[model samples]
Target chain A: MLTSNRRLVVYGIAGALAIGSGAAFAQGAVAAQYRWLTFAVFAAIICVTMYVTYLAAKRVKSASDFYTAGGGVSGLQNGWAIAGDYLSAASFLGIAGLISQYGYDGFMYSVGWLVAYITVLLVIAEPCRNIGKYTLPDILAYRNNPKAMRIVGAISVVTVSTFYLTAQMVGGGVLVKTLIGIDYEISVMAVGVLMLAYVLFGGMVATTWVQIIKAVLLVIASLVLVMLVWTPYGFSLPAFLADVVGDTKVQAKVAGLLGDAAKNMTPQELGQRFLEPGLYFKAPIDQISLGMALVFGTAGLPHILMRFFTVPTAQQARKSVVWAMAIIGGFYVLTLFLGFGAAKEVGPGVIASIDAGGNMAGPLLAQHLGGGPDSFLGNFMLAFVSAVAFATIVAVVAGLVLASASAIAHDLYVGVYHGGDIVPPQQQVRAARIATVIVGAVSISIGIAAKGQNVAHLVALAFAVAASANFPCVLLTMYWRRCNTGGIVLGMVVGTVAAVGLTLVSPNLTYPKAVRAASQKVLDGEAAKRSAIEAALASGDAAAIEKATVDQKALDKAVTKAKDDMKKVEGKEVSIMGLEEPLFKLKNPGIISIPLGFLAVLLGALLFRDKRSEELWPEVYARQNTGILASKATSH
Target chain B: MATAPKIDWNAVIADPRFQALHRRKQGFLTGLMIFSVVFYFLLPIGAAYFQDLFKTKVWGVVNFGILFALLQFVVAWGVAIYYSRVANRDFDRMAREIAADYEKGG
Candidate 1:
């Protein structure tokens, strides 16, 4: 315990050192923009989280406490923590930016994410908590041959968790770079170290409190910012909308994107743009696909599921989920406004200049509405927003790291390597910390490689993978009576491969390459025309030949220039125009892939169905009976 | 020819701490669930109505969603606490009663 405390302190100091060095080296807008009060507030939140972890740690008498908070957590706390875990930087920051840029299409993410909770309630959450030990593998291997099933389960867990972890790390780097102007790699390293400290020293106890504090702080910050936006205009919503509508650039963009017909549309029509698909009638199908990806991907996330185990009962699990959904749903709705408000106030040109992807919309909006970025109030708000974004990344990454570490140490090491022999609790904790370091290193490496990529898109890819791979296997094991070990293993592999393979080859992945090629082609054509024009003047010829040659050159130049300009405009227009269709098509492949996984499991079960002992059915029934009795006996 | 297995009441109610823990957990859970259900339904509508009344547009939408989510979590926490207290209390009482009966050889 002392060692754990000491390690936590050391890790905290290391984080401060990293931040301090980065702050000192930062230049221009970021250097003078540091808000001491905001940093202090962020630090205070971390300290509070640490204290919560200490309390939890004191109660951790067994591996159960470390892994599942002894299954004693209340529904409300667990619910908030789960929400905190699920609302990553992508959802908190990315959603609003997306809404601002894409109109109604962006709201699809919120609906998809919120709806996933229903699936969780129906299929995965309660059953998983009821049966599993520390990880999903325990549930998979519950009745079937334990050895092979455990190994297969571990592999699935590692694959999904690693991909998800990479996305969080990449987001962390971007958040830090945007907020503090630090080197992206350094920011990634800073987040990795902080997360490593969190999981290694504090374990789940630390991770949970960090999430809870973050959720509260995020809510408070967003509310305060929204209130401030209203304060300057006497708290009148009509006045605010009038101001937003009066902005010429915002009006122009709205008109251009929505068409002339949108100018006369009602507010309800405007709001509905976010809710219904096909509102952007001219947009490609990828836009619709992107919307679906955001919506469905929320259900299959691993970090989100692990949070349910912290609570004691299935009922608490259910209630907590309800709470998490409400909170998450509310947050996403706010993001839509934040995105639009920033676009209206700051102007799209400025936003595009700062970050073409629009991840900085929230902070940029704060600066525009509150004061200029250099003003004291503006700087403070900027710092606060940056700190919130940073904290959001850290909180989410910590949960992801813990999930991966548990999969390795608890599921793989104990379940597979030791043949499920009972290991001492202390040794298990030690192994978990070591696993954290290994996962942390891998995350840092991925983050470095993923620099300059869109964090949200990468996160969506992670979601697609989780939905296709882990969700099917876990869902089937819980609900399907005929599912055997072979079925679970094969389904996980097939789903994982299908999702990853499709995502790689999908038009969405290849569209960027095509755009780049188009740009190069335009540039090359211009160069060739210029060289030919210069050569035409140098060559001497007969009058007839020269006249024909000059005419040909002029004609060729005119043709080349027209084509080049067209290509340039087409490249820009098509890049934007082609955006929605490819993404929508790419995203749906997961829906098909997920069902395909179920079919794989069903087939495997049928093939292996006859091998089942009659004893298996009775044992399953007995376990259910005992579980019910246990619940009743305990619930006074 | 066949005998039913005897009930192990002693095993069922052996732990003294279980009752107190169970009761506290139940009370906490009941309160939490009630709070969550009420707030979850009310808050989103409240936020939406408030946004509509004020015409806050983008900020209004964002706030409504965020507040709803936050309120739901608060309710979940309340429910979890209620269940934990009830479960601990009932289990402890049963355990103590069984232990006492065993001591008396009843």
Candidate 2:
């Protein structure tokens, strides 16, 4: 034990250093911003969290604590942890950016996210807690069917968690690089190292506290920012919101972002416009698909489901959800205020100049509220909010790493490879800790690879997998007696295939290339025409001048023609991959894939009905219906 | 894990008391799930199919769309809190009773 522990420590330190050194080689170039205050705040946060981890490490003596914090977490604590876990940097920054840029359409994600908890609360929470042990597939394998189910379960959990982990890492890199003069790769490594440390030593207990602390910070920051935004108008929320919409500068930015529909409106009219839909989500199908993805996608998120195991008893699982829903629901409402606050407080011009993606709205708003961007207080607030974002990312990434690692170590390694009874507890825990380092390192590398990528789309695709592939299997296992190995496998395959297939050919992948090339061609032609005119002017000939001016008209005509050509194919079904048109147009695949996922389960059950599935029903039912299996539930 | 619950769950499942418990729990859970599906989908569906109606302003700056969107969070919270209360009072109690009844060979 002593020797292995020493080896583990050596590995942990080596992994941490590897992650730290990794940030040195990333492809990020935006190192234009730096603030010592942000660094100080980040250092302070690291100290506090390291202390929390030390506390958690001392207590975690077994696999149970490593995976589920010994199932001793309180409902309220779990609630906050879930909120922290659920509200990724996307929720903190992206949703606010969406609302700031797109008006009411941005809040759609928040609403969908909040309501998703109802599905978890009502359908998944109690059952998942009751039927499973360390991982979700624990429930699927509880009835003597571990081999295929565990493997599939492990794969889905790892896939979803890795995607989530990658997104957090990318966001971390972008955020840190933007806030301070660090390389994006280095920032990603820093996040990875810290995330690894948390999972490696502290396990679920430390991860839970990290999340809870971050959640508190996030909510408090949002609340403070909202108050600062509203206080300027004497605390009349209506007046402040109207001012946010009514600001002439805001109108211009809105017009620029969304076109003329948002331009030249009176305060009342602009307010109404902002409140109405269609700022970002232009199509009916797009909005519906996004909504479907957010609602169903959340249910299958491995990190979120993994949280339920941290609390003992199915009842606490149920209670934690209610607590989570309440906290999450309130936090989302506050995010609306944060969105509006950032829009009004920071202003979009500053937001865009800092980051074209508008990701700087929250931090900029913090700066603006604390006096000005350069003020001591401004830097302080900015640093505080930035640290909250860092904590948020770290907390979420830690959970993802822990979960996927457990899926590997608990479900696949011990439960599947070693069969049910072969692997010892100590070995399992050791494997899980090692798995954390491996998963964290892998995600950090992927994070470095995806350095400058738009993580929003990646997150959406992850959601697609979660909803269609992961959730369907989990739902089937919990509710359907007829759902056998074949049914589960079919559901996962169809769901994953449909989602990935649709996304591959979807407008998301196709639109950028065609649009960029077409628009860039027009700009290049216009630039050439202007330079030729400038060349003609240098001759100082009256005839040349007149000829050049006349040629300008032709150039204008050419530009018009170019624009017309681009418009004709703007969103048309044009082949993305050498075909006449892309096979899929919808940006989100959830609406199609989720139904396909369920259909596959039905078809598989009917077509390949397992003879022993009926025989296993008694045991499955027993596990789900009572607390009697609680001991067995904890065993594996 | 040690000494599996000796109660005959097959018999318990067949018992009317267990059946009632299962029926009640399933009914409530399924009912909430369906309601959530419809309730949550309405905003997206309404935004898609009934844009004009959703755009209609109910207040000075607030439109039906924003109101409906915000309403979802409220309704979701209401459903969660309401379900929590109901489950604590009803479903959990029913489950405990059924378990006890089975153990006692009722």
Lowest lDDT 10-residue stretch of candidate 2 chain A: A25-34
Candidate 1 reaches a DockQ of 0.05
User: Candidate 2's residue-wise lDDT over A1-636, tens digit each?
Assistant: 544444554565556445443444322212224355665676677767777777778777788899999888988899999999988888888888777776777787688888888878877888788777778777667553578889888888887777677778888888777766468777787788888877888899999999999888888888888777776779765666677767654664555455455556554565456666766776778667877878888888888888988887888888789888888888878778777777777665556556656777888888888888557787788878887887888899998898899999998778777886767667878999888888988998999998766566778888898899888888887678788878888888898889878987877664544664776687786886789788987879886685566556646765775676576566655454554445787889988999999999888877886656667776567557665456344543
Candidate 1 lDDT at A542 equals 52
CAPRI grade of model 1: incorrect
Best by DockQ: 2
Give the best candidate by lDDT.
Answer: 2
TM-score of each: 0.74, 0.88
Candidate 1 residue-wise lDDT, A1-636, digit = tens = 766676666567557555646564344233353546456656665566666665655665556666766666788888789888988887787767765665444544455566556556544565566555567676667666677777777777677777777778877776676667677788787777777666766677778888888888788777776776666778665465456555554544454356557878764445433332333323333433443344345545667777767776666676787678678767765675676577667765456445555677777776665577667777767777777777788889888888777878888888789988889987887787688889888888888998866444556667666776677677666555677777877787887777776665555453544555655665566666556545765665454344335444444544555565455456353333455225435544555666667787787777775344222533332232123222332232
* For model 1 chain B, the run of ten residues with the poorest summed lDDT: B1-10
TM-score (0 to 1) for chain B of model 1: 0.40
Q: Which TM-score values does chain B get in all models?
A: 0.40, 0.87
In Å, residue B97's CA in model 2 sits off its true spot by 1.3
Clashes of 1: 75
